[model samples]
Target: MKINKFLLGAFALSVGFASCSNEEPIKGDNGGATDGEKYVTVRINSVGDIGSRAATDNDDFEGPAEGSSEGNVTKENIRFYFFTADGMPFVMSQTGVNGTVNTNMVKPDALNVSNTNGDEKTSLEAVLVLGAPEKYVGNRPAIMFCVANATDEAAFEQFAKKRLDAIPDIEVNTPGEWSKFRMTSSTYKEGEGEGAKVIYYTDISDNVKDTKDAAMANPANIYLERLAAKMRVKGLGEYTVMEKNEDGTLATAQYKIRDENGTTITALKVNLLGWEPYMTANSCYAVKNIDKTWTNTSLFNGWNNADLHRCYWALAPGIVSPNNNTIPLYDNNKFKYGNYDGNKPTENIVYTYENTSYQPASVTDRSTKATAILVKAVVKLEGSDEGIDMVEWGSDYFTLEYFKAIVVEAYNADKDVTNQATAKDVVLKKNTGADARSNTWYATVKGDDFKRFSNISWWQNGITSYFVNVEHLGSKYGVVRNHIYDYTFNNVVGLGVPGDDPVNPQDPKPSYLAARVHVLNWHVVSNSTILQ
Candidate 1:
């Protein structure tokens, strides 16, 4: 059921979703400032998180009883919001529209997530500021939600305010459940859809019980989940930065994605359609359906093989593109969603760019395995999306929903999905001549070979070109630590992987961290240039 058409209170069924947001109300967590308020430390993607690891390509967990785990979450740009019993301000309803958003309800500073570690203090959160007892309107409870960036925040509010009863619609058919998420990778720098929504509820009766019910000043904790995947490209060629030189020169080049400001991006959209992430038959609730009467726990369980195939063969639970809904799914497959029996496959949706005139491209299950993440990059200069390269990486399942592994064992050693160690479909890019993978095999004096690797570039060639899998790209030989390197330099120098590997394997000076590139310049090579 599209969240836009639904009522409120749909999130409990694990259906309604919203984008991330923030403005200013309380300041005691990450930012500087505090009003001596008791802050609720909410952790996102904690252990046993709803989105967890699976068999292959982070595929759904198995068994008769569908269960879930706390999967890892890496935020690039995130924002969240909290509303009191009082419904969200109508002004804050529709973002980037006729009215303005109530920034006061949001954090003064947005959560600028580069690599958000859900377990660490970095992911800590609290309400902006304890809302006025009057502000905490309703007698029921308050709401908490997270979205990708600013655009999503506006869209969510706009829809919520329109509902007549209980604004910010928390009812079963509320707009929250109807909220559309960007399930696929981002095609442009601005990002694709409003992204996904992760929301929860916290009782605030103590804060808004009676007119005199005050003194309940505290920041609440809120956990968020990404309904949509995140993917972007780096603007430099395929070179991993191994280390920085004494004179400030790059010893080796590696693939580390950066933003317009040249900041090292630790994570990208791994997978929006994550493993066992509330899918088919369980994706949501059908308030109007007379057949299967479902509940919250029973629905948002996980994905099963039967449902997986059904999702793949379906048209979609929602629209493919948020902006442009034309060019419907050609698969002509249909399934059930809510009360409808001909519901389209939600996973089959596409992630295209407005720059491409909303022309849908191959970011689908039929075309490639790495359907989850799209590496968006500005290859020309800095601060410009002129030459954006939207490249795909990951396996075919769940579109292999976003891969966020650094130095991960990404080889399909068994060659197929058999013993599924690392994404079973992920093949080792066969490097030739100097950069061959077999060279990384090291035989110690003990007659034992320990395969070591550096932050090397692993390319994934698609309709776009050869894009690097930064997560698995490591060095074959290295004690060289993590160092920042400039991509535009003529000498793409890495620490140990010298300018010339023919004579001696170039290794850089020692350091605590391994190689890393602060900035990136990507080159999406044509099919002819593919190494493998």
Candidate 2:
């Protein structure tokens, strides 16, 4: 039994390629090519054309090595799907050992190929022996789709089992069915615990040739893409950090915003809690698809270079709200806290399916809202103790105790000598007929009816949040697969949304957070927003 060997190279860069350990012999009665069969060599490329976009502030996380059996781009198994020249599905006859071979796939022998030119490295290859009926020899398969790490028919919506003994067929020409095929966890059976697998697939319709000799000489190239995007939060430089002591031990953490000269703001402080993905999509198509009417196409200036398999925008499931709204305290899967070290980026990163909003007219529009990072933090005023919680009213911020004193003074000014009130007499105004949720602080004197007066209780617990919408290359706002979003907070000025609500969080009124976002190759994209 002889195994044909070839080479599969990494993407445009010298990384993210998968290699097989040993060649599995092609098992069949006919050891080699039969009368109607041909040999087609394919060089699968792992993630191609991640652009040369530079990071403005922080570096991206390192991708996994090709030889390693882990990471996002690793290919444990690969399968091929064929379509005739006329767009008809081509089903291969089950050859090899009956129970061992799937008609749609062939396990290739792994051979590492090193490029002498140093343009690329750690290549993988697979040689396929394609058999066809003698009658259809001249008009064999013309289009090929390569998929990696999708072995289980029970796992993917694209490979959902319709009957036993064989995988169901797909309508190659049916755009609706093809676009609906996804690699996601939403299709798993109840309690299957079979989380969504990181699957990669590519279309090589343009690479196929008419004859076997032509294909052998010019092996078809496939650039596999994972149907998800990655994001990381990093902080650049150091800050004037202030530690709050409780019982003579440091209990709370805070940082003072400084000017360009490193002069600290002594009156105000901020305590960064963590960040979570807002409006993140749970699923993406196995093969990315784009809308023909995507007018923001101009924004993809250096994007969608097929030669390098790099794309900037993709159509993803639209999400109006966050899947989870629980305010995370410590570190968890959904939320990650930044432990600043004044040297490197904090270990705050996440992976999510592409989430896009088509040419959103305004950021506040819920129907076309883009995916964002919800950064949670506590804004406080420097005090004798740890810090003092503040409340927002009208146009200014007042400490909780100070705001209470103003409310008590207002009540006394509105009353006679016998009707004067104190701090304990003030309470939140109650909602009544036709009135919305009372956003006012009310005065309830000894026997006087409660009177609604001023704004208060907006900043509950002194916690605030800011939403930083992820952006693509050009004019649009979105997250695309195989790209990295690195966001670093340079400085947080003023106060953000009072009482940060994970869902429906409002933009900061007077203050804002200055942050820089870099998306890497994972084509890296850089976005800088200065909040005032």
Candidate 3:
């Protein structure tokens, strides 16, 4: 980001001044003086682009090999929404020579925003220059920034400038509302994810008092949380990651998954996954393993963002603990919920890219907790029949690929044991839909609908990958039970009966896809019986 010494000097002179000599300046400010001497030179240190995070979507806490997107963020159409700490939107009143605004807004020099720097080592760019906000003039001030990618930059820009209230309702293609104007909190708790130490506004400005430090404790650092969960391909054999201190800790497995067509799938894109707006204060936060991870993160005392998350991620929705689905106010070791082993939750719960942060969006009741990732698939495997070739769930097939989702991680969290069910060439029957005491998509086959068997949840708590040979999955497994659930919505079943205009969330009756997979007989099932 080229900072024109000339422009910076002129900008500093014009803002807050009653008059200016900006006869040749970009803005109307020819040149002027200001009353207050507070100006924040915010550099865009975008944390967590897809490439940097791809490697860490694993058992390892620090991100992947420094430059693998793992297919998270995109290299093109990068955008960052700049705003006040209080959520007030800011427009681009100025852009230097290299600055240009697509439908989406851009900072003068965005480091990793577009991956222009070539790798995770972000370029020396991406910043927002601001006049001292009047609200925080006397009080300590801070800024908020969010990163997102959009196909249509103009559409994103129009959306980004609106008040948070109106942002969700507007419909724009490519960048869905959830992925679009739906702004996520960039203010991550320190030490949970990877990034530089956040800079306080006081530290950047002329303020001598560290009022913000006293009020918020941690400095204001903005991290772009990964919106998409990662799904990597691997064989049936479990590949455990040893501690770095342990011999061969650096060793890791490389998983490659292919579609029915045999095309190598480097990474799979995900959508319609569960996302809840910032949990309202005092709402319940249960079993988001990161919370448990936090005890060790900050020693269970304060918010430590980077240290808390094993893999900085968006929480996948579902109840993994089969024993208890109840969400508590919080779990800081007291009144804390335990895992299936009846042992209290701990930070060392073993990390996986697929998270178990199933905090209820509205802890008030069951009616409003409907945010889920919808999924439906149709594919013809090498020699599989029609039943095995196509699989469809959710309200409609007409929904775009953006809505089709995959369940990455689902486990029985309540107890140490999971249900053991077997599918004999299962083309699982869609037993019922939307209405029933329990709508189970039973893996029972009537005709040739069944193909080879596969488990929904991998034993190692990662994504379920394909293996051409059942022998590859192993020889000591039994039933692979894929737990299918149905929903009861507000007078609508299956995503609002198809024709609803702008068929999206925020509709009168929305549908969600939050799943939990419980497998039985890990200690008993033979690989021959399980894979066959």
Best lDDT goes to which candidate? Answer: 2
TM-score of each: 0.28, 0.66, 0.32
> For candidate 1, lDDT tens digit of each residue in 1-532?
1212111111110101122123533333544323322223333321112332232233222111111111212122233344444545212332211112354233233222322333322332222223332223343224444433223544434323332223222211112332332111111011113642211233333332221112222323232222222112212233332345578544433334433344343312111111110111112111001112222233222211111111101111232323311111111222111110113223222212111011112211112111111211112113332332222222111111122121123433323565334323322332344654321221111222213322232212111111111121121100000101111111122211111112212222231112222211010011101110
Candidate 2: clashing pairs of residues: 8-124, 23-109, 27-96, 49-308, 299-474, 519-524, 519-525, 520-523, 520-524, 521-524
Write down the lDDT of every candidate, Cα atoms only: 0.23, 0.46, 0.24
Residue by residue across 1-532, what tens digits does model 3's lDDT show? Answer: 1221111111110112111122433243212222222333333322332222121123112222122322133323345444444534544334221234332234332232222335334332232223334432233333333444443545446656654334423432212222221212233233334543322111222321223222122223333332222221111111221112234222221223323334232321211111111111111111112232333334322222343221222123333332112222122232221122213212111111122333323211132222221112111222332212122233222111111112111211211455422232223443333431121233333243222222111111111111111010122111111101111111101111111011122222222212222211100111111100
Model 1: residues with Cα > 4 Å off, grouped in runs: 1-31, 36-40, 46-105, 110-121, 124-127, 134-141, 152-221, 227-301, 304-532
* Residue 297 displacement (Å), model 2: 6.3
Q: Which ten residues in a row have the lowest lDDT in candidate 2?
A: 183-192
Q: Model 2 residue 452 lDDT?
A: 48
lDDT of 3: 0.24
Worst 10 residues of 1 by lDDT: 476-485
RMSD of every candidate to native, in Å, equals: 24.7, 11.5, 20.3
Sort the predicted structures by lDDT, highest score first.
2, 3, 1
- The numbered model that scores best in TM-score is 2
Model 3, position 447: C-alpha lDDT score: 43
10 residues in a row with least lDDT, candidate 3: 5-14
